[model samples]
Structure formats: C-alpha cells, structure tokens
Target: MAEHKDYYALEMKIDQMIDELQGLCSQNGLSNTAAEEVVVTSVFLYKFLSDKYMHNIEKFAEEIGESVDEVLANENDELDAFYDAYPTDVVFHSTDTIQALINKSGQPGFAAMFDDTLERISNYQENDKFKVSTAGGEKEPLFTRITENIIDKSKRDAFAVAIFGIISESKFDFSDAFGGNFDFYSTIFEYLIKNYNVASGTYAEYFTPQSVSSIISKILVGMSQVDDNKLYDVLDCAAGSGSLVLHLANELGHGKFGNRARVYAQDVSTKSTRFLRLNMMLNGLTESLDNIVQGDSLTSPSQYNVNHDPSSGYKKFDYITINPPFKMDFSATRDEIESNWQDTDRFFAGVPKIPKKKKESMAIYLLFIQNVLWALKDNGRAAIVCPTGFLTAQSRIEKKIRQRLIDENWLKGVVSMPSNIFANTGTNVSVLFIDKTKGDDDKVILIDASKLGEKRKEGKNQRTVLRDNEINQIIDTFINQKAEDDFSVLVSTKDIKKKNYSFSAGQYFEVKIEYVEMTEDEFNQKLSGYVSDISRLWNEGHQMEAEIKKDLGGLIYERK
Candidate 1:
C-alpha cells in the first residue's frame, strides 16, 4: 500500500492525548500507556487510507464519545466508559507501544483479511443471496444469512464516497440493508488480525467481518423455531466481528436455548477475538460475549483456555452453525490432532491422512465436518455452507464420512444452489443439513435450485435470490420429502451408499439441458463444402508427388 503521509500528523495528535489521559488515569490505577494506544489506533483509523479503518472512522470516534485526543486525556476512572464507547474489545497495556506501532501497519490482526475464516464471513453475502430459496410456496431469506463490513469511523464519509464512485452505475440493497449506507461495516473494528491479508479470492469489498447485529438475528430465528429451542449455539469458529453472536443475543425474545445455546465463538486471530468482544459490548450483547472465547476451533482447543472442549469435556450443543474457511491445509497438525483428539471429539472417527504436498486437497472443511459432528448432541442439527465440490467430488474419505453418518446419524438433505451462489469466490456453495436425530423419516431430501430468482440490481456482478414459491419448494422437499420431477428427490441412505455415496443430483435426477436446433439444410450444405475442399487438396498433393518422383528418376539417370 502507498503509505499515507498525513498519518504522521494524526498519530502525533493521539500520542499527545494519550499522555494527558495517562496522567489523569494514574490516580484511578489506569495505565496512561493503554490510553495512548487507543489514541494511536483511533488516529491511524482516521488518517490512514485503509479499507479496514477508513470506512468506520467516524463511527468509532462517535461511539467512544470523544475524539482520539479526548480519550487520551481521560483518567483510569474513564476506562470502562471509554471501552463502552468504542465498538471493539482490544486490551492495551500502558507499556505496549509496540502494539501501537503494529496497528499502524494497517494489517489485519489475523486470518489475513483474505484467510478462509474471513472468507467464510465474506461468502455469506453471496450465500445469503443464493439462500433466498423456496420453502412451501413462501418467500423467506433462507437461514437469514446477513453480511456486514465494519471499519474504524474516520473513513466512513470518505469510504462511502469511494464506494459511491465504484458503484456509480450500480445500486445497493438498502431495503434489506440495516442502514442506508453500504459502508456500515467499515466502522466495526480497528484491530488487524495478527496474520490477515487481503486475498484475490475475497468477495467482500474489504477486510471487515460481516456485521454482528445482522447475523445474530438470523441465528435467533433458527433457535426460536416453535418447537424445541435447545439447538441454537450461536457458534462461530472464525467469528470475525462477533456479528452473529451479538445479533443473536439481541434477537432473543425471552429465555432461549434454556440458556443452553450460549454464543460459542473462536478465532485464531486475537484481533478478531478482541473485536468480537467490543462489538458484542457495543451491541449490548456483552453478557453473552463473556461466553464467547478465542481459539482455533479447527485445531485442538487452545492450550490457554483448557477448561472447555467440543471434543470431550464441554457441554454438547443442540444447534451449530459456522462459516469456517473452506479448503484450508492442516497436514502439519494432523498427528497432533489425532493424539489429543477430544473424547466427545468432533473428529471422533479421525480423518484420512493426506500427503503433505497435496494437503490443500485435504480440504480443511473436512475437519470442520468431523468437528461439528462431535460438537452436536443426539438431538442436535447443523446447517452449513459446502462447496459444490462436496456434492460432485468422489473420494474414499468423503464416502466414509457420509457412510458413518448414514449408518449412524441423520444426514438429512442437500440444497443445490445457482452458479453465482458465491460468485465472489470460485466455488459455488450448497447447504449441507445434518440432523443428529431424525425428525420422523430416515430418508434424505434434495432440492436443485440452480435457477432461483432475478439477478439483484445492486450487484449486477452476480446473482439474485428466490421468490416465495421457489423458497416453498425447498421447505416442501425437506418437509414432505417429495420429488419434483427434475428439481427435487428424496432418497434413502442405503440407496445413496449403493451408488457409492454419490450426491450429485444431475446423476440421480435428469436435469433439463436446453439445446439449440440447427436446420438440416444448413448442416448438409456446410458438410458438403468441407468434403469438396478436402478432395481438391488431395488431388493437388498427388500431382506434387508425381513431379517429385520424376525429378528423382532424372537425377539417377544423369548420375549413371
């Protein structure tokens, strides 16, 4: 990135404020150094041209109820109020000037803004659009997938202006969007994940996680279903902004999940973890936020937080949902995973050993698949986004996983999505629904929704969503286990296993393929012309060969 020359001025101002706040806070037992760190980050957010902070600059300033300078001047007594004001949860020691310098780098704290965890958060945009599927002739946002981008407040105005320029010809989905501005997510966080970097594969406009308030609402709906409510865990292994958890807490009408489905979110990124806490608090979900922890859930539980484990000792969940990075490599940790694998372990059955060179092919998601299974209770269910490859690819391991579920649990159904279901990324995704316990029938349902709705106006770059009727079919397929000639099919696990665990719908169901008809006369004329040209060329070649032979014979006689 081109370094911002103006950041020096901004940083200096915050540095001065930090000194003032330190002096004021000393009597109250607060470190002036920590206060300075806040000022430095706030300044960096305002002056830097980072996609992460520039977008949310003003909001961060407003939320904290003071300019970056004022925070630094405030005393230790103001620490709680200051923390309450900002929308992030980063802790800074008074002496941690190194961290201030690090934040100035404009890097994501971890998950490399483009890492798979952040990718999962970004993928939700396309997933949400694709998920507006059919269920029993009614239109509903499937799974209520919401997308957001949070940034430091300073750049909100400029970033909005920039987005306005980029989308000059395009429009935004303000109707569905919580706020009128498309840049709302920019102000959500300021801490960079320790390792996050932007990737070419990222579909989201920037590095910010999807908005916390928006995602939690969706999980609440899933948890609030009329019957049993014990299933919702508000789980996010790559919880970027803690948006889903925060939103879920707000969405809860009353006692929910028997308070059983607590928000359990983790990420390898300390920046994300801290931001998750801040967002949870900013959104009034801090009580639930305390339940949110940090760690690499895909790996074995972190050694730092040793008390809970989804594998063996921790309480089991009723509902689990997460957007883990798709297809990451863990060849290095394979052995460690096996040795310390949890008792109620998500990887109870263990994964096939993949060669180190071909580890990318190992599909990091396979670990998530096993982990989710281990995390669930006998009555728990999970709905997750799977790449189309999961449905089309055939492998011994995939089949083994499927067989284990068919022979043991409820692998309820598959929902095929349109090509642009996740156009921001290469792989189009489908939803994999697995029930730890079968509802009534043992058979699984399938719905082919390659064609959902009109392409959305705001993002002409890709897809639209499903109308009410289309959404209804999805619900009906799962609810009734009905087959719609080409769109849906209900099959037993035994039958799927007979086909060697094939999940490809087109192979089992004859999907319609549109063909173009050509006139017979046009075809015949073209064929005849090609034949005539070939014959002429053949005769020319024969004449050239005869001439060459005659010349060779003449040369031989002359030599004699």
Candidate 2:
C-alpha cells in the first residue's frame, strides 16, 4: 500500500464525481426518476470510497493511478471489499496509523476471514429465509436494499425476505452479494431473509415495508409520553417479518425503559418468525430474541400464551403493536385459535363466529383485536394497524366487535393513515390506538393522515413518513384533542352512535382546505334549522305511511 492523501482531497474527488454526474444528467434532460437513481448510486459509491480511503488518501491516489475513472473501472465484485477496507469511524484519524492498527489488531483479518467463511457456513440457507438474532444485532442493517427502486415479483420476494433477514441474521447478505443492484424497496425480502436465517422454525408472511414501518414507529414514539416503561411485555400480534417489534426495541432505545420494557413479537408465518429473530439481532435487540415468537393471531396460539401466561407470573409486554394481514378471512375457523381464545379460560366476553375460510374472512383482524386485548396488561396501550374495514364495516359482525371493545373500555382513539400506506397491499388501513385502561371514557380522537405522505412507487405503499414533528402533531391532537375542520375530530360516544358507529376516519374527517367561515351562533342556527327540517320530514313520512296503510286496509275490506 502507499501513503494516504488528506481527507479533504478525497472528499473533493467524490464531490467532483457528483457534480459531473449532475451536469451530465442535466445536459441529457434526465427525469427526476433517472436523476435520483444517479444521485443515490453516486452517494453509495462515495460512501464506499470514504470508508475505504478515509485515512489512507495515498492508497486512493495509488489505486486511482492516472485517474479516478481508471480506478473505478477496475472495481467489480472486489469493490465491496475495498469499501469494507476501513470502518468509517476509524477514518476520522490518520490513515497510516489506522492501517498499522488494522494489520496489528487482527480485526481486518477476522472480518476478511468471516467474509470468506460465511459462504461455507451459509450453504444450507436459501434465498428467502428469515431468521432471528440476539439483542446485539445491527440497528442499521448490513446489505439491505430498502431504498432500492425496483418492484417486480422476484424483487418483491427478495425485498420481502430481506426485510425479515436483517432483523434475525437468518439471511447473510446473499441478495446483497447476488441480487442485481436495483433500487425500489428499502430492502429485498428474499435476500435479507436468507442472509439472516437464525430462526428456530419457518412461514406465515414476508416482511412489512418501510411505509408501514414509519407509521408504526411514529405511533410508538408518540405513545412514549405515556410510555409505560414497565410494560415490558411488548407484542406485535401481526408481527410480519418481525421488523415492527424489533423497531420498538430500537425506537425505545437501550435503557429508555430499562430492563422492564421487553418485547414479545409473534407472526403466523415461519419465515416471518425467523426474520423477527434475525431483526432482533440485526437491530441489536437480541435480549428480546427469546421473547420473539411465531403464532397465528387469528387461528393458532404459541407456547408463550398457553405455557407462559403473564397472569401466572410470566412477564409479558406492557405495549402491544400489530400490523396484521389486512382483509384476511379467518371467520370460519375462529374456534381454531385454542391457545388464543377457544380455551374458554382465555376467551373474553365477546368474540364473533369463526369464518369458514382462513384465507377470505376478516376473522384474522378480529382475532388480532381480541388477542391484543387479552395480551395487554390492565393499563397497556396498544397501537395496532388494521384496515378501514375494521373501522367502517356496517355488518352485525363488525358492530358486535366494536361494541365488545367499547363495552370493555379497551377501545381508545383511532389514527387514520393515508391511502397506499402499505405501498404493497394497497388496502386502506388505519392505526387503532387502544388503551387497555380507559382514559376519558366518552370520546375517541380520530386523525386523518391521508395527506401526509409523498407518492410511493412500490405497490400501494405511499410515503407519508411521520418524522418526529408530524408524529408530535398527531400525538398532541390525541392528547389535547379539539376537532380541526379538515384533519382531526374529537367525536363523543353519542356522535359515534349518531354516525352509526362507523370509525372510518375519512367519513368523519377530511383534508378539504375550504374554509366555511361563520360565527358559533350562526353555525348553531344552521344546524338547528337542518335538524328541524329533518324532524318535519320524519313526521311527514310517518303520516304518509299511515295514510297509505289506511287506504290499503279499506280497499282490502271493500273487496272482502
């Protein structure tokens, strides 16, 4: 190797590439889409270079020889190794000294050997495996392609698996090594799943995507003010790929809640279960790995609830967050969830008839609703994701569920998300934030976040990612709710009944910016007039029905 150059020169060279790329793109009239690709890819390259030559600019100069172009040309599969040559953190100091340390510490050697040996150890793993890891896993995942923009079936499968693998380390960056460098989803399910396959078993579903993740994180962070640190029994009843609960560990941070706030993540799919564990490890949340499990919220119960009921002194979560499959039918098999509810002891005061088919009925969401209630401690707060069907359906079945929850006072407020939040499923979904212990029992806060995200390219997944600021707005609305004209509403229990108990956020709220200016008294007069008109019509309609009935009766009598 050669003596290194200064960090400033190295930084300028990368910036120079970006500026040139920008000019070239501009000359070509590149679309925003195309330009974005170049920018991100360029950033990735720069990041690689910065990591590789942070201390050893001489190494970069020598590697480049005549020009940076020549150096880049020589890189192929070996590019990854070059980039991994130095830890980005190590670059803050001198290059010569760093290289000496790399040679001396055996750290570089261990990493190199690990890289070469991982393949052999991972031969048994396939492309779409999801696994689990210990608490010390990586919060910022290695080799996940979440920000990539490609969205085909193969990519979908890969992204789905990758989503699971990073959490568990079940998949070992296989896709990162093999999959073509296409950008669309934040990561590939297939690649990540196989890259981190440390699961005890295997397959219910793939990973939940970024759009959904943002919504989930925002809710938990919002709930942190009232975040019951002692609520360690955290559960993602619909724990797809295990990312949601693992994220909980990351968001809550180490010691944010001390050892008291542990997570218990469950998914119906073996793949998801595996990924959940892997995610825990990748996110350095392995302490809760043992707590992460696989179970069907709708139909099956794992050993956790049956063998380790919290009431029996087994510790469970204080908060439960779920993003269950939307519109899944488990109506026919409601009774099959023996561990969850059918076990008479676990069954609550209300559960509807099981659907006939697990695939088509909405029973899965229902079971999740019931299960979360059961899983919660007396005052646990749960922020679960369910489709608009849960909030808007007008069937007797739905009514009973809503009633049961409200009667039990487990129903809290609901947060309505933007359309296309899932980006993949495309179903209109909402976040139902419930408190096992009721706060103010008479009102429910409803927020419509439909206007929050930017347009997303993946399937119905939109991108209204709630940053801390946006999340605060929502939390504040819920905490000190006064209905806004076009965004949020604080509806009383009586109003819910007046509106037929429909919890569709859009039905009760909107983002229509049109201002209807009027004094309170003016508005009240208009409301009173409308009410009087409706009453008059009701009376008239009754009179008309009576006259029709009398005529019909007289006609019948004459005929007799």
Candidate 3:
C-alpha cells in the first residue's frame, strides 16, 4: 500500500513538472510549435538527469559515510577518487548542480548560465554515449541551447529562472523509479508527448498504442527462456517514442537481465528521436542511447555503420519490432533505394512503384518490412504492425512479400487486431510475426482478434482497447498454437501458398453448414404458410399498380 501511494505521488510530481515546463514555453509565446516541444521536453529531461545524478551522489555519499553537502565540499582529488571508485553513467560537476544554479538565479545572464550548465553536463567526457547521431555523420548532444528558442531575448532570463525555481522547489528524487516497471514509465512518457504526437497533415509521430505494444512484446517473447549470459539485440526501425522497443526490452527481463539486451532505434523525425532518447534515460536503458539514430531508416540506416564498415551490410539482430509509417511521400528516395541497393538484397521482395499521382500514398511500410527480414538473424524473430489489408492483398508488392515469407519458411504467425486499435487513425492493423528458423512443416498461428476490445473515446477519435484477459487469451492461444473456433487457426506454409499467400485468419477459417430435421407434416405446413403470405402480397401489389396508373393518368404533361 505504501508503495502504491509513493508511486502515485511520484507520478503526480512528474506530471506537474511537465505542465510547468509547458506553461513556461507558453508564457514565452512558444506554445504548440516545434520549438515548444523541444524546449519542454529538453528542460524536463534536464531536470530528470539532474535528479538522477543527485540520486547517485546521495548513494555514493551514504557509502562513504558523509552527508551530501560534505561530499560536495570535498577537494577535487577526493571527489575524483570517489567517482573512480563508484562509477556512474551520468557525471555532473559541482557547478552543474541545480542547487548551484539556484544560487545564481538572480544574477545577470541567468539563461546563459543555465544553458551553459546543461551543455557542460551533456558534453561530459564520460557521458559521450548519451549523444544521438544524425544521418550526415554528425552526433547531436543530449542538451542544446533551449533558451535560444525564446524569440524575446529580454524574457529568456526569467524563463530560465522559472524553470530552475520549478526544479529546485520540487526536489524530485527518482531513486525509487530506477527499476520501475513498463506501465509506470509508459504512462508518463505517453502523457509527456501527447500534445506533440497528434497526426498533422502529412507527417505524424505514429505513436503505437500501449495495448498493441504489449501484445507484440508478449507474442514475440513467447515461451523463450531468457539466457542470462546471452546478449540480445532488439531493433525498432520506425520506433516512435520508443514504445515498441521499450516494451520488448521489459519483456526480455530489463529489470532482471539488466542491459542484457541492447535496443537500436531509427526514425526520420528529430522530435521522435529526442523523445526516444528521453524515454531511454527514463526507463534505465541509458546504455542504448547511443544506438538511437535520428535519420531516415529506409534511406540511410545509420545503425548499420555503428562499429562496422558500411560495406559489410546491415547488422542482424536477435529480435526486431516495428510499426512503420503505412504511407508517405518516399518518392524522393524510392528510386535511389532501387537503383543503389538492388543487388544488396535489402528489398528482396521489391519496392513499391512510384505512382505518377499521389506519391504520398506510396506504401513505405513495404520497404520497412523487407528491411526487417534482411536484418533478422537466422534464428531471430520479429513482429511488425502492418495494414490488415496487406495480409489479403491479391497481387503486387504486398502479395509478393507474403509469398516470400511463406516460401522462405520464415512466416511464424499473424494477429489481425481490432478496428480503431490506434486512437489517431482508424486503419485496421495486423501484427506479422516472422521467425527465420521455422521449419517447412511448422504450422503458422493466425489470430482474428478483431472482435475483442471495448470502444472508448480518445479525444475526438474512438479507439478499441483490449482488456487484460482478452490480451492474455490472444497471447496464450498464439504461444500454445491453439486453434480456437472462428478466432484462430494453425495452418502450414503449403496451405498458405495454395490460398495465394494470404495471411488473413478469416481466409483459413472453416465455413460451417447447419442442418435440421423436420417431419413431413411440419414442412408442408410451413410451405403452405409461406405460399399464403406470397399470394396476399401479390394481390396487394396488383391493386397498388392499378392505383398508380390511375394517378399517372390524372397528371397531364405540360410543354414549356
């Protein structure tokens, strides 16, 4: 009970921090814009990292039998020795502390002092792994000059002071949240980015629902024993806000295994990459922050060039989960991908042809699916969220992709999700699970969970949310390969090929027929009643036809 209360209080405090930061952005006329998102999230992250650093410091102080103040007052040599003995991921200098900044809040150029402190902390030599890389081979630091976003230079100092005041007064201690569960951080992350993740015009953040993320994570990690000695690599190419990858990490025993799995993520949106970085730090997956790339996953996959030569091809992973953009204007790079990498076998199924019109409607997810197939190790598995229609596509690229999956014997199973599963878009989606080690004779599990989930209004959109038991049912059936009536089916690759490589569960469901026995007298009585009703209807129709003719005759035709 006390634990629950503490969790609730911590959640409220975090919410207040987000709200205050957003309010500060609004006060400076930066509300609801790209700059606002960057400012609010950055400041929030700054405070989080600061508190996390302080938490470590307090722990170190306790170990040394000294108060936090005394530990800070130590000479440089003593402090250096202490840090050497007890290593930490985030290192902060004495002047970078929030209390240090609070002391100088009333001084001139406070905003510069604030920005300088954050910059120093981010650029710390030991914290190099916290940086994210761009496609152009440039590494982006963890913190930038956030106060510069304010157009009015006069208000920057006050804005920075207000931010300091919020952090200093709140005194957030995230020590308890270090090993927190997925639900705790997932909720906070979603709420933090809710205002910025909405679909606008063409570009969208494509945030995956927590329920869908859970289903994918559970099904992907099904029945597999976690090897403590083995290091797993998980990738989500279109990882918006890192929900899918984070959930998969939690499933792979993030708290227990503890960095046993390295998460690699790539996305074109810088906003999403920033949020993804924050999410990694918040979830105690700071070791994977360096793997987060802010670039086009389809065009230039930077994860491939992390520690290996680009000529050696992409890095294979133990597990991959992605919810790629369903459609986008990838025409700019479509031809480049086709011409440059045709022989690389990255797009083994072939890329979608660029349409003369509506280039934005090009199916970009097709390329992501093929990339996933290529990046999977021989025994590795993956789960992808794709348009439900892709499963039953009769011809073209979609059918070819399905055919290849079946032909290669890598197709494991598919789960067709309920309608409105995502609150942002109403597109019906299905999860495609791929396992390269599946034998030719292994049966593929297909689940039609479209009937599950209750409807609820999320903002202006109505979405379907799966209940805990329903999600469990889906997972249990898939893992056990249970063929429930009308809900799930287990079919072989040969059967799938015979049906034109369709992965829809409904296609494989048996069409049942019912029969009922009746006595001869009863049949005759039922037939007689049907004939009497038909005769009465026929007589009424004739009378009505005659009346219509009379009425038509009364209406005279007039020429104009």
Scored by lDDT, the top model is: 3
Candidate 2 on 1-560: residue-level lDDT in tens? Answer: 00123333433443444444444334434424433333334223223323334324345546645444443445553334444553221122231222223333333233233223222222323211222322333121122332233333233333322222221222111122212221111233223332222222221135554445555665655554644444355677667666566555555554554544466665655545544554443343444654554555445444244336645543345677777665665544555554445445344535555555555654556656666766676767777778776787776656766766666666667877767554355567788877666666777778887776566443222344445566667667776755876778877666777777777666776545667899999999999999999999999999999999999999999999
Which portions of model 1 miss their true places by more than 4 Å?
1-197, 205-232, 242-253, 256-261, 302-312, 342-345, 352-361, 453-482, 510-560
What is the C-alpha lDDT profile of model 1 across 207-316, one tens digit per residue?
A: 22332223224422442353445434546555565544444444443355343345666666544554555444334343354445455665534321433554545656
TM-score of each: 0.52, 0.54, 0.93
Clashes of each: 61, 90, 0
The lowest-lDDT stretch of 10 consecutive residues in candidate 1 is 141-150
lDDT of 1: 0.49
**CA lDDT, candidate 2, residue 48:** 36
TM-score leader: 3
lDDT of each: 0.49, 0.51, 0.84
For candidate 2, the 10 contiguous residues with the lowest summed lDDT are 177-186
Q: Higher TM-score: candidate 1 or 2?
A: 2
